[model samples]
Target chain A: MPHLRWARALGASALLAVLLASAACGGGAQPSSGGNSSGLQVIKIATQSPLSGDESVQGIALKNGAALKLKQEYDQFKAMGFDLQLDPQDDKGDPNTGVANAQKLAADSQVLAVVGHLDSGVMIPSEAQYHAAQLPIVSPANTNPNVTSQYKYPEISRICGRDDVQGPVGAIFAKDQLGVKTVFVIDNITAYGTGVANAFKQKAQEIGLQVVGSQSIDKSETDYSNVLTQIQQVKPDLVYYGGLYQGFALMLNQAAVRGIHTKWMGPDGVFSNGLVATAKENAIGVYATSVAAPTNLTPGGQKFIQDYTAEYKENPDPYAIYGYDAMGVVLQGLKDAIQKNGGKLPTRAQVRDAIRAITDYQGALVKVGFDSIGDNIYAGYYVYQITSANASTTGDAKLMAQYNPKGELVSQ
Target chain B: MSSTLQTLPQLVLDGLVVGFVYALIAVGYTMVYGVLKLINFAHGDVFMVGAFVGTEVLRALTAGGRPLSPWALLLAAVVAAAAVTALLGAGIERVAYRPLRQAPTLILLVSAIGVSFLLEDLVRLVESIHLGKFVLPVPTVFATVYRIHVAGLQNPLTIRLNSIVVVVASILMMVGLTLFVGRTRPGKAMRAVAEDRTTAALQGIDVNAIIALTFLVGSGMGGAAGALFATQYTLVTPYMGFDIGIKAFTAAVVGGIGNIPGAFLGGILLGVLEQVGGGFIGTKFQNVVAFAILVLVLVLLPSGLLGERVQEGA
Candidate 1:
């Protein structure tokens, strides 16, 4: 019995040591409490995605984008009464991390308004804390409708379109634009993936497009040759992948190798230039729908792109645009709240109210916006076609297409 | 069916390319196992350290505003990584394995786990910030030169110059190793030590020198694998070792523990199996296939593919 107890204690100690070491080595995974330092007005903003393992690209983009915006706007922010600063944390794209980050942010009094929890999985767990704290969080990229759709409180919001809008648009384009009727739908079997795929399939079925096959693949998968072969035999004209760019890119490349000639369509996860770079020629004819305008083509997007390129010397990722715009919205709301509260920095509740009260605020990309469910009210999606001429073309198909519910091309 | 068949050649070709890289990693695992009769779990991290060391060396060369040629950079990377890895491996053995020399098997294994944790933490502590994080930047060999292609496919199968170098260097190292082990005095001492450590010590073989040499050789292989793996995969993170380590261990076990030839065979077979499984099943279960093969092989032939006889007394 003593031996057994000793062994158990040793195992526990070893495990504890490992976790503590991991935390120390990976940077302190501590919950930030807004320390009321005498001179520094420390404000924390956070975004969550898979930061540690795979899907790290998207997470990195989200983090850098938000950080860049905060850095750029810091001088102007300090000129005002509040000494604005930004604190970013990693969620590692897990819901557990999302919850932890959210709780941490909520607990910190300096965190007035938050920027992200990129994946819907992370957002779902963190939103409850944000709601209870009345801390407004604007998701730059999360597309799942449940993110804000069924929220008990409306403090949580997103700048991106819901999967309901984006998914249907993708399905309509495949059926109408690409002449892909008998189609297969494949989700990555996550909240975001399944949600978008379901919406696409439902809309496609309604439009007389036969949903011939549907399946789920784990997110970490890099090959889809076997599934592609099965789909090839089914002779589907298209395969709808409701996953992020990482899995989607691999799937397309492998499918191309397997000679699966079907057109591939996905939502915003396939929007990154990194996705295009990885997929290469395999990504040709692939399509993804975005609720917001493409950053390269947006009105002020060109300026942001030039500024970002000059600053980072790397091309500004699309998600960065949303993040920049998200910070702009929060700043605008905070400004309004500060003015309303007689030049004093408003309480967390006042800031949350200011965000809710926002209307017709012009932003960097478009007007600053939110609806009842905290989704963008002016929901417009852009359809991009990857073609032999390269998806980054200056042609008709490459131009953002506006689509209505019935699959007719609306005037862009 | 015809299209899928056409795709097979391309898939297999790429699979073999990846397999060669895996074989490089498996060699280190097998080498350590051969002499120590203990799996150096930290071998994969040694590969990671090599990549990091290469990064530091290349970055220094480029930082002086004199961008070295790809060949120069590659040479610098190889030498720097080899030196760093050799030191790291030796240090790890001295700190973690030395104390456990007469301990139980479980303690040695535990020490290996501790070493892995320690190395990971060390890397992470140095690369704390994400912005200036350690990135294993590969030379533009893949993008610029030695692009492979099939006539029909639109996408050219890109086999990078660096990858070719990696394969060539690995082969040379293996050949050198075989020659050294077979023909050199220290090599024979190493073999003798593996056969019977007490007897080798009685025959006037410097036990400490041989042990240090074992680490040097094993970690040197790991370093080469690291540079090659980084060049081929095009991404290197501190935690990258854990997954690759598991794969390499599986390769070593499948080939036969403590058998150098078996490790090579095992790695190639594992890589081919992964690609074939992906082609047949889907990419999602690619990891499952590797482990499944390990289990199957262990059940049927515990001695591994090379059929090496195991002596109980070390």
Candidate 2:
């Protein structure tokens, strides 16, 4: 009877502990009412990317670049009586995960703006949730025109050029500079891949380059020999792939095995030091196009790169500078919103409005200005050729050419 | 000659090369399932761990800036991966699965899944903590030595020295496993235990020891496969095990779940079918083709191509 009474008392205490824990969690979940008890106002800039999978290299670079910019401006914003923080979310490059991330960011009342959703396939679906929340999201590397063409979300924008521009630039380069008369195009069948491949195909044909054969491949399948075998028959002058680094590296390796030694070219998705590292010697002589030039080339971009390397102790990926620029745009907009409200933290709606009003803002890579549909007006594609397949250093890639908005290759 | 006919040899070779790797992993799945009747979902993560083991070994070996010969690197990788994963397999079986031996099959399966996720996340967390990054770049351990061109072929088929070594090593392992299971005392004990654990125990066979041995051999095979796969792909992530493990399981089921030869056949067949199918059909449907074969096999012949039909008591 005494033991039974002790057991009952223990159960009562356990129940009480559960109740207390639930109450604490409930209090924590509630939106913070402006300034915390410490009298410091806090706001979050959320970043969504494939931070935990095969594409995490690019995603982590983008996140770090954005975080670097926010950290640099932390004290400056503190001077105006506000603390800015970064809330990084991993979407795993999947649309469903992207939507979940968007909802999570939307539910967090402290998050004022977002800087990512790197893959266009992810951005397309997740944009609706962010739009419903009236949260402004700027993409650093999404290129599919469909992401912004419909203007479904006024708060959605991208600092990078669209596929319609980048793909055509690739086609023009293949036709004019490389003298590629016949080409074979392959897409990984994602929204970004198909969109860019189609754009490249159309431009190739219009510019008098014959597209001999076209195919779509599953991105998950590492063995590309069967497809490469089929490609051997076509024997096109150039092979253009619209996919990420993983698939492209495998295809290139398989193509080497099959003795199909055609010149290789790909869109901005394949533009990364990771690709060069992944492909090894196969990456040599391969051409990739990016919407922004490498940060080491331009003076302002070089300064940004120097700071980034000094901070992170490594070179930034091609998209990292774009992420930095995107964060710069958002931080500038936040400053404008704060100043407009007379040294008070602005509402999410005010920040969104300020982001849309940004124009001719000189960024690390290019001039940041949005068109009517939130597309960067000054965005253009730059071509890079892998001069060396050295993965140990990031300087293996050399900028070969640049294509303007008009799809003309220009002198660097 | 037609393009398809001309490329047939290369395609088949490519398929077989990958098929052999799958077959190696499949042996682990079949051997474990044969004795335990539980699908070791964590088997794939074991393979992933093996790959990391191999990577770490090679990284350390090459840290002096002087590279080891391809053969030396491959040997070191296989031995290191196999030894580490053998212990891990035994540990996993002891920690996660052994406690649930008397539980319902469903419970054991759930525990296995939990173990799988735990291993994956644990690897990620540990690797991230140590390296400050999750994605580990596998150094080029083996360089292509020669490109062999057969007579009457338009293109020279790439004959990577590493590929030949992988194929030979796999065959040797397969032969060794077949001999061990078919001839040795421990192999006979394993067979008896697989046939009936209670009867084997009554016959004075050490059931626990045999089960642990089965895990050791299966996991050793998986570890070797991981080392070879990392060398071929030159990129290893924590999640790499999931896809390959699923495919290897499918291969085991396709060949015959509890049959050793069946696992090998199923793996090679599935690999060939995927490559040939991807080549003939569009590559977009390659995965669909692989899984569709599984569904079709299950529907038509539930015992799989090489599986023996067993009777269940009503």
CA-based DockQ, model 2:
0.39
Q: Evaluated with lDDT, which candidate comes out highest? A: 2
**Model 1 chain A: which ten-residue window has the lowest total lDDT?**
A388-397
Ten residues in sequence with the least summed lDDT for candidate 1 chain B: B134-143
DockQ of each: 0.10, 0.39
Tens digits of per-residue lDDT for model 1 on B185-247? Answer: 988998888777888999999887898788888898788777666655544567677777878
**Who wins the DockQ comparison?**
2
Q: Which lDDT value does model 2 have at B56?
A: 85
Best by TM-score: 2
Rate residue B234 of model 1 by lDDT. 46
RMSD of each: 7.1, 5.0
TM-score of chain A of each: 0.86, 0.90
The digit string of per-residue lDDT tens for model 2 on A1-412 reads 7797678668957965875575444321223334556667888898898877778878988988888888888889878767777888889999999999899999989899999977999999888898889899988888899898865577898888889888888998888788899999999989999999999999999999999888898776566767787778679999999989888987887676556789999988887877877777888999988887767778988898889899888888877887888999999889999889888888888888888888888887778888778888888778988888876443378888987876677764
User: What is candidate 1's TM-score against the reference?
Assistant: 0.76
lDDT of 1 by residue, A51-163 (tens): 55555666666666666677777676566645666666778778887888878888878788888766887788777888888888887888888888767476887777778
